[model samples]
Each structure stands twice: as C-alpha cells, then as structure tokens.
Target: MQTQSSFKTTETGTLFLVPTPIGNLDDMTYRAIDTLKSVALIAAEDTRNTQKLLNHFEIETKQISFHEHNTQQRIETLIEKLEAGDDIAQVSDAGMPSISDPGHELVKACIEAGISVVPLPGANAGITALIASGITPQPFTFYGFLPRKGKELTEAVTTLAQKPEALIFYEAPHRLKKTLQALLSTFGVDRKVTLGRELTKKFEEFIRGDLEEVLAWATETELRGEFVMIVAGNPAPDATVSAVATESLSLPEQVEAQIQQGASPNVAIKTVAKANGLKKQVVYNAYHELTE
Candidate 1:
C-alpha cells in the first residue's frame, strides 16, 4: 500500500535505474547518458565492462561493484549513501537493470528504505526481438531464463506450455540447442517460433519457422552470441478437459495421477496445487499423508 511519486521532492537521494545499450551504441538514449554523468555513484554489475561504456560517453562518475555475488554485501552501503542524500544510479552490463540482471535486490532494498527509485527506460533485447518476430506481440510473457536443471526445467516448461500468450526467453549460444530441444518436446513440432541472434548487432540474424525446423537449424549451424526466442502460444488449450480430469479426484489422488503420467513428485505437486488453487506445500503434505 505504498505510493511512489518519482519526481516529488524528498530529503533522501533517489536511486536511478538506468538502462545501457543492448548492442548498438546508437540506441543509448540521451536521458540515460545524462543520468550516468550526474549520479553521485554508479553501482554497476561489472566495473570493467561498464568502464568501457563510461569511457565512450566521457562519463567520469565513479562505480562500485553490485552484481549477484556481492548484492547482499553492497545493499547496506548503497542504502546508507542514499539515506544521506547522495544520488546513485545503477546499471547492468547491458539492457535495462533488473530485467534478467542484478539490480532487483538493490531496488527492493531502496523501496524498503523509502528511497525514491527512478527508472530510465532504454534498450531491452526481449521487446526488440518481439516486434520483429512476426508473432502476436500484444499478449506476450517475458520469461528471462529457464531453469538449468533437468527436473526443474521440465516443470517450468510444462507450466508455461499452458499459457495463451507469446513466450519470450533468453539463452546463451552454448545452451541454445538443448533449450530448443526442450521447447520442441513440450510445445510440439508445429509450434511457431522465431530465434533472434546477436540482436541489434552487425551480424544479427532471425530464424522464423516451426519448432521442428528451428531445432534442425540449431543442430546444423554453429551458434554464436546470445539469443532471444519467441514461442507462439497454445492456440487450442483444453482448459475444460483439465478441469474435468481433476474435478472428480481428491487432491492426493490428483497428484498421484500426474506422477503416473511421468511427472516427478515435485512437479506433480506443483501441477495439482496450481490446478486446485492451493499451495505446493499443502499438496505435498497431503500427498505424503503428513500429520503436521
């Protein structure tokens, strides 16, 4: 129940979330440049990588490391500085902060401390690839990166497969083939997909086709740079069938049924819990017949 008036005058310093260029330097907005030059301190994901951008823009503002590994350690210090009315700007190596980057924790801390959080929108790879993907872009979900583990990945993809909106995912070149294969198995061979490689760069390329075609192309081609994948939604989701299948079964029985269909216990619990609008722990406890 907290309201944030971004431009309102306040004694505490504002925490600016600045976006850097995803690929093309020309995409960097003037506002982003001005903020970078003006902030008291720049909390960057990687100081070395960000220094290159600072040098290019002639921004001499100092930077402190604020990545995943050092997030908890840095939040206290950053909050202290903001409380003292020294404005700070946070940036990632590229793209918007906290969008698959390391600025979320700091942003949360700032909110909790009642510091102003100002976001300057600029380059974003997900939306950049989406518009040109030729897929319906209105109802799209930006799923940053999928779980890397086998069981976890299966559960995540299974849940996302039921959604009716276009799904966007980011993947490294090394894991591109495996992720595409995972999507092929869950989304089926005929699902429409587009793969944008090295987006906004000189060697940018887009592959548009069905899942099967994209999988084949990934197998034969040598992948380089990062990629953005746009997967078409399920055109004919059978929600009625799912509802009917679970209505007659007890919660534990419903979980058992999913396991019989080859889902792991955790995955089965998640599916049944989501279907019944209950928590996973509740389903897990019921399925295991735990008294506590």
Candidate 2:
C-alpha cells in the first residue's frame, strides 16, 4: 500500500496535476495559476497551445513537451528530474489532464517513485455539463470518449445501456451525429439525453430531450466545437428484467433472443459477444450454425 502526503516536505519533488480552462480563460482558478508559477517546470501536452496560455498569464516558467506521442520517452526523464528535486506541473491542451488527454503515465511513474502528486482542480467539462443537464446527478459514470468504429461503438453502447447511472461522454463535433445515432439505437428512443456545446464559453448552449428528439435536432443543426453528452440511465426494473432473462441463455440463444427483441443481427451478435466476453465472430458463427 502506498500513501501520499501532498504537502509534506520530501527529498523528491512534487508532481502537480493542474487543470486548464476548457474554453473560457476566466475559468482558470487562482491556485492553478499559482502552482503554474511556482513549479520548476511544466510538462505540457501541446507546447504551442500551452505557450499561449502561459503568455496570457505572464507565466514564464519553462515547459517540456509531454504528450501521447512522447509519453514513454519523457517519463524516465521527468522522473529523473523529480528525483533531483525539480517540481513539475503537467497540463493538457484544455480541461483536466488524463481525462481525454495525456499526463496519466507520468503521474503513475511519480507515484511509483514516491513523489507527491498534487492535483488542483480548476475546470472539467464533464462535471460542468452534468450538473446543469437536468438529469439525475448522483451515481454517475464518466466514460471519457466512446469508440469510433461501428461494431465497437455498438458493443460499447450496449454494455453502457445496462448501467443504472447517468453516463457522461466527450465527443468531437465531426463525430457527434454518428455517436448520437449509435446511442439512440442502443439505449432506445425515449432515453433522456443532454448535449452541452462550447461549454463555459460565450456561445455555450445545451440541448436536452429524449434520444430521438436530440438525434433529430443534431441531424438538422451544424455541429461546432467539442461536446459533452449526458445520457440518462436505463430504467432499473427493465434492466433487471433483461439481465435475468439473458443470464441463463447459451451464446447462440442469446444472440437469437436479442434479434427477436428488435436488435439487428450484427448488433445482436456484438452485444451478445460483449456480454459473454467472447469474440463477435465466435458468436456470429455459433448463431449461424444454430440456424443452419
């Protein structure tokens, strides 16, 4: 067991996980600014973007490029510096680091090395959107981003559909419509959803309604900026009934049953495969053999 005392004085340097503003600059907190100014170095996801932020705050602290592409290469170097007692702050392009961005690996290395990791929470797009979404707030699951591929997305949504808590997801504008369609198909038409766009910015807006209604609106609207989607959970009684009905079925039987309940063959196969921890092709072959 490892314990961390964030403020305790240690021979090794502390690793600060600082959250940058998601959109509006005014959202940046005082402690985040103070930490950025106080740290020995800043490990930034995008040096160029981070430089712009530094310029705005007049923070002249040096930055080292630490992003997904260079994470493995940089962790060792950062650890060495931390061991040498050089305090470092890590930041993403926007929002909290390691949410849908980088910084997780370095944090892990620091923890393993017994270096303190102090996180100063400033802004998070997911929580900001959730509180105002008019959805049930407690007992929520934050799924940063869903898979983009068709089969994988369907499988993911199918698994998430069984959860009895609000679900949060981050999506890019270009893929919003497709994701909403996938959610609509998996979670059903009447499931409640809220889409928050340009959060905390001057043009911030939210669209709240059932999945079917939001899907229609997304189809007609021109999507811009990143989005935070809050999806209401499945009804507990229905989810419980469905789980009970499927728990005893064989793989082929499960796929057939899903198909009988209005799911397409491909979706049924993927859902059954995911639920059983089996490959989709295996479920597909099994179901086909049963039919043959």
lDDT of 1: 0.86
Residues 174-279, candidate 2, lDDT per residue (tens digit)? 9988888777755767789999999999999999999889989999999999999999988752342233135567777877766654567888877777656677
Q: What are the models' TM-scores?
A: 0.83, 0.85
Model 2: per-residue Cα lDDT at residue 41: 98
Candidate 2 lands at a TM-score of 0.85
Taking the tens digit of each residue's C-alpha lDDT, what string does model 1 give over 60-140? 999999999999999999999999999999999999999999999899999999999999989999999999999999799
